[model samples]
Target: MKFYNRETELEALSKMRDLSFKEHSQMTVLTGRRRIGKTSLILESCKGTDTVYLFVNRGNEAALCKSFAETIVREFDIFVPEETSFARLFTFLMELGERKKYNLIIDEFQEFFYINKVVYSQIQDIWDRYRKKTNVNLIISGSVYTLMNRIFKEYKEPLYGRADSLMKLSPFSTNVIKDILKDYKSDYSNDDLLALYTFTGGVPKYIELFMNQGATDIETMVDFMIRSESPFLSEGNILLIQEFGRKYGNYFSILTAIANGKNTIPEIEEALGDTSVTGHLKRLEEDYELIKKKRPIFAKEGTQTVRYEISDMFLRFWFRYFIKYNDLIESQNLPLLADIIKKDYPTYSGLTLEMYFRQKMMESHEFRNIGSWWEGKKSTEQNEIDIVGIYADDKRALVGEVKRQRKNFKPELFNAKVEAIRKKALFKYEIETKCLTLDDM
Candidate 1:
């Protein structure tokens, strides 16, 4: 439960703090998907400062105002009069902020805009009126991708030019998770660590589940996670719906289709029976931040040939195994679920190996850029390339494929990746080619 490793991010926070010590106020926007540990990073950053942590919820303006006032009162030891409204509540805080410097973190800030649309204007007014002398370091954090993006970056929004620094707290890299497990004396092997990355992709909360379940290996962890009543069993449902709203069911189906190898739009639509998924795909990529539209390596700017893939690892695994078997799980058909997991786990994990490879790439200093590349030339001519590592300069690149199976990467597998990369025009760039197994990586 204690913070383990966020040294680089903490250093960035320290820089922000130093900047806030100047005459002007400072604002940092921390954004990421749900459960990526934005709140934890901010709390760690505000360790010794005069910090007020206000979390906005799904409630009316008046309810949020009351909660804000109470938190401020408790945090700063401010005295409140008999009664107050939302405007008066913030006005008092503005006055106090002008007098003394403090760190204020507003978590789940998108909820405020939904509940009361004018809260941003009110804060902007107070900020414009009195921010010069406040010296307050404000960091607003949120998990809602579209709303939070609009709040900070949209030109028409009230807080458009307000941010001094932006930090998107991504999931921890595999090295960070390895450090945490080592610190906790968890003694898991490299393969076990890779397996964890396969399933969770370094989400701290999910890692903690395996830790708590005493799962020293992947099999036990899967057994613990796929149960009907486990916290993580239904976690993707809650997290995805929170980000994407009721439209999540459609997005989930699309993701499931993609994970199960229905890569093309037509293929995914036929598989899910959701002919309206074209519109759903647009929102899923642009708004919800769930899946990404990946073009081939040499795609032109106006290329319409692209593939949709789940952008998050846990969701990828969730849709692949858990969501597809939701009925059996809900009906408490444990034996059936277990049998499916046993039968298809390697197949599922062979796909998840891409995530584990990406994690390793992120941990390595050699690769400045890492992503996947594929070709969309043929209908049944499906070409797949797993991991692409671009070197530090624009001069060089490394094209590679990853397999999680125990067997060696045969000559055919390597040749297929090479052929696919050539079809993608990667050879035109003079890129190096490498075929990697889980062991080679």
Candidate 2:
């Protein structure tokens, strides 16, 4: 459960902090989804330095500022008015920056939108007025992806273009996951690795929870996740409700359909019994960033062979099992729900295995483009290639067939599929065929 694989991010933050000390004030914005370890990374970077960490909780602004002032007094041994507003506290901190250097970290910076929506404008004014003379390293972290994007990226927002640096933290990579497993269970099997990837998707919080409960294998992980009073049961809903709000019904339906294997627009519409989901789909992809629109590697942007997929592995699993079996969960049938997941986990993990290899190939940095290739529609299952990676040099490509069991991968049929796609390929390049199974992990 120890921190793993944030060396690059930590180095970047260190450079920014050093720059803040050498130059004037600098603003760094850290953004990621909930439980991706933003706060941990920030605290680790600010260790051994003078830091004032302010956690934004939903409450009256004046009361919140009073608590913040107490923290400043305890940490920095300086005093200001206890009843000062957030605006005044921020201004006072900036004035202090003019005299000395310190790191000012505001966790959950987006919560200010709920406490007092105008706080952004006020901070913007204070930052612009004092930036040239202050020597503070301002670090802000937000878990609400959509709100953080709007606050910094939108041109019309008050804090737009104010950040000197923006860092978006992603989940731990495949190698880091392997290291974690090796530390926890040195004799782990491929199934253990796949189950960890399938469930946690390298999210630090979830992995820590499983490791703390000694759930080192597939069955134990499923039991721990589905037991009564398990936090995993309600995690997805809690993560998305704030972003989707009152209109979550349609979004949930669309996501569940995709998770259940209806990826195309027509199939999803048919499954939902609705025709107008274009706007919702766009928002899900572009605004919320929960889903991604994927096309074949060489396909044009206007190609009709587009598919929608949940970008987060954890959410995909949650929608597939937890949301789909809500009735069983609500009826206090945790045993039944766990049994159902255990029954279908093989097939589910098979699909996730394909995703795992694709991600691994992406992290290798050997390919310029990576995606699945299908000759015909979804009905023609034989014409699909599990993975296709165009080499970064542009002269060679990798076509792979992925399966859960090594016995299920037929080299003859897979080679024939590769040849058929090669003939239809745009360029006359060399194709290397590969058979991937859990052994590759």
Candidate 3:
């Protein structure tokens, strides 16, 4: 469960801190989904430095400020009024920055929207007044994507355009996951790697949970997820209710439909028994970023051949199993639910293996564009390519057929599909075909 990767992010943060020390003041905004290790990264970066870490929770502003003042006093050995307001405490910090340099970290900063929404304006005023004369490296982290975007990216918001650097953290890569597995179970199999990728998708928190429980393989990980008190049972709902709000039922239906293999608009509408989901789909893709609209490689933007996919791997798995069988979970039939997952995991993990190789190719930085290619009017007749990666100059491409087991990959059929795509002449380049399986990871 030790920290892995993030060398680039740590180096960027170090540069930001050095800049704050040279120039009077600088503000950095860190954003990511819940449990992506934002707090860990920030704390690791600020180690061995004078830092005042304030965790913003939902409460009365005066009460929260009292707790923050206590932290400042304990950390810096300076006494401020316990009853002071946040605006006053922040102004005091800015004043202190005039005499010394330090890092100020505010975790879950978007909670201020619930406690006192005016706090953003108060900090804005204080920051503008003292930024030029203070030597404070201010860092704020938020998990609420919509609220953070509004607070920092929307021009009308008080704190808009105030940040000198913005960092969006992503999940660990395939190699990092391998490194983590090697650290714990050096003699791991390809199935272990695929199960980890299928379940955790490189999210550090979930991986750490599985590793802590000694769930190093597929069956144990599935059991750990579907047990009576497992956090995985409710994690997707907990992470998304705030984002989707009251109309979450419709969003959930759409997502579940996609996860269940109804990716096209018409198919989803038919599955939902409702046709008025265009706005919801747009919001899911553009606003919430939970789903994405994908087209075939080399397809036009206006092409009607589009598919919707859940952007998070874990959410896809959750909706596919837990949400799809909520009745089993609600009735306390966790063992039955785990059985269902075990029965269906092979088919489900086949698709996830395709995604794993696509991610691996992307992380290699060897492709200009990467996506799937399909051509047919009907689902039964569609000739689909698992992966297509075009080089920078467009003269070379990697067309891959991915399968869970190498034995399942039929070379003749794969070559026929590649030939069909070549007939289209989508890219007048040399296409290299390969079969990617779990062993490639």
Candidate 4:
């Protein structure tokens, strides 16, 4: 598929390149989760330019330096002495930048932690010595969020405060996905569109995989992704293990519980056999950003009522089926796994539809705040509202429930819940109630 969005990011990167030449060497740090296209964006920005690209793979430090030295020699077309470490190789590049201006892209930069822990300090020393004299636009990209944050965002780290620009890449928006779907299949229905969003979550790499195999429809996409050779089966396992480190077991258990609908603190802990998960959950939310903590709309700051949801759409779907049915996966029963997901998809997609409308509302930029409201202690099926939006000026509110079909909606019961929230919290504003289905998308 063609590059859909990121016009603004490309513009900013180009502007930063100009600024780097005007001032001195400018360091740019780009971070996002795995498969979010950080590397693709960087490479796209350097088309037809003098660029040296280095991938920091997990291996011997000296061997990696030799590889990078070869790349530098190939890109610059000059004879150079061999270097044994990144520190020496990088110092050579910085000195070379004094005369030749080029783009220096280092991808998977966090892997330096495994190759050589002192690489950060070495680069910091080299950068400080040559920054004012060098003219290179140095861009470093990483996928591991925690280690990357520690390397640049924390105060004590050597690279802290060194970046001229820091950008966290986000997923493609709803409209971008719709346009891409139309580009591939002009006759696509809202169900196919929702399935694409539900499965890929607008992440470029996953979407590319699906589209490459001609998996434009729901059944085809499910078949391609759930097979034995498919990458989706092990995606969550590999990526999160890299992020959470050695104590990944506990984190995985907590995440799996949340994905399976054990949302609340107590419920997750119980599902994990009473494992102590409070600290783990906090890290997952505030640090890893894999899960989001949600409270009811108009809820107080000190409210004890809280719920957790996996923030990544693809991972949410993966954990719900791929992790939950490890027995089927390990036995290579992929047909059964696909069947199970097909059986459960209707109920599952209904929940995803709620998120679709919530995202649609957010895209409009019309709401000051958007969330669902539920009663505190006496909460049950009757008191839950799937979506609530307070208008930007606080004059109107949008309250609604989400369902896959119109016949499944209960208008009278929903109005009763709307009245309850109106009297309890939103009494001051005019409210609009809606039942968002697939057609709304």
Pick by TM-score: 1 or 4, better one: 4
Better of 3 and 4 by TM-score: 4
Evaluated at residue 3, the lDDT of candidate 4 is: 70
Candidate 2 ranges beyond 4 A from true positions: none
1-441 in candidate 3: lDDT tens per residue? 677789999999999899888897999999999989999999899999999999999888888998998899999998776664788889989999999899999999999999889999999999999999989999999999989999999999999999999999999999999999888899999899999999988999999999999999999999999988999999999899988889899999999999999999888999989667899999999888899977888989988988888989999999999999999999999899989899998999999998999898899898999998887434342488889999887799899988877998888888888888888845488988888887787
Would you list the C-alpha lDDT of every candidate in the order shown? 0.76, 0.92, 0.90, 0.90
Q: For every candidate structure, what is the RMSD over all alpha carbons to the true structure, in angstroms?
A: 2.9, 1.1, 1.2, 1.0
Q: What clash count goes with each model?
A: 0, 0, 0, 0
Best by lDDT: 2
Off by over 4 Å in 4: none
Pairs that collide in candidate 3 are: none
Compared with the true structure, what per-residue lDDT tens digits does model 2 show for residues 147-266?
Answer: 999999999999999999999999989999889988999999999999999999999999999999999999999999988889999999889999898999999999999999999999
Error of 1 at 252 (Å): 2.7
TM-score of each: 0.89, 0.98, 0.98, 0.98
Candidate 4 at 5: error in angstroms? 1.1
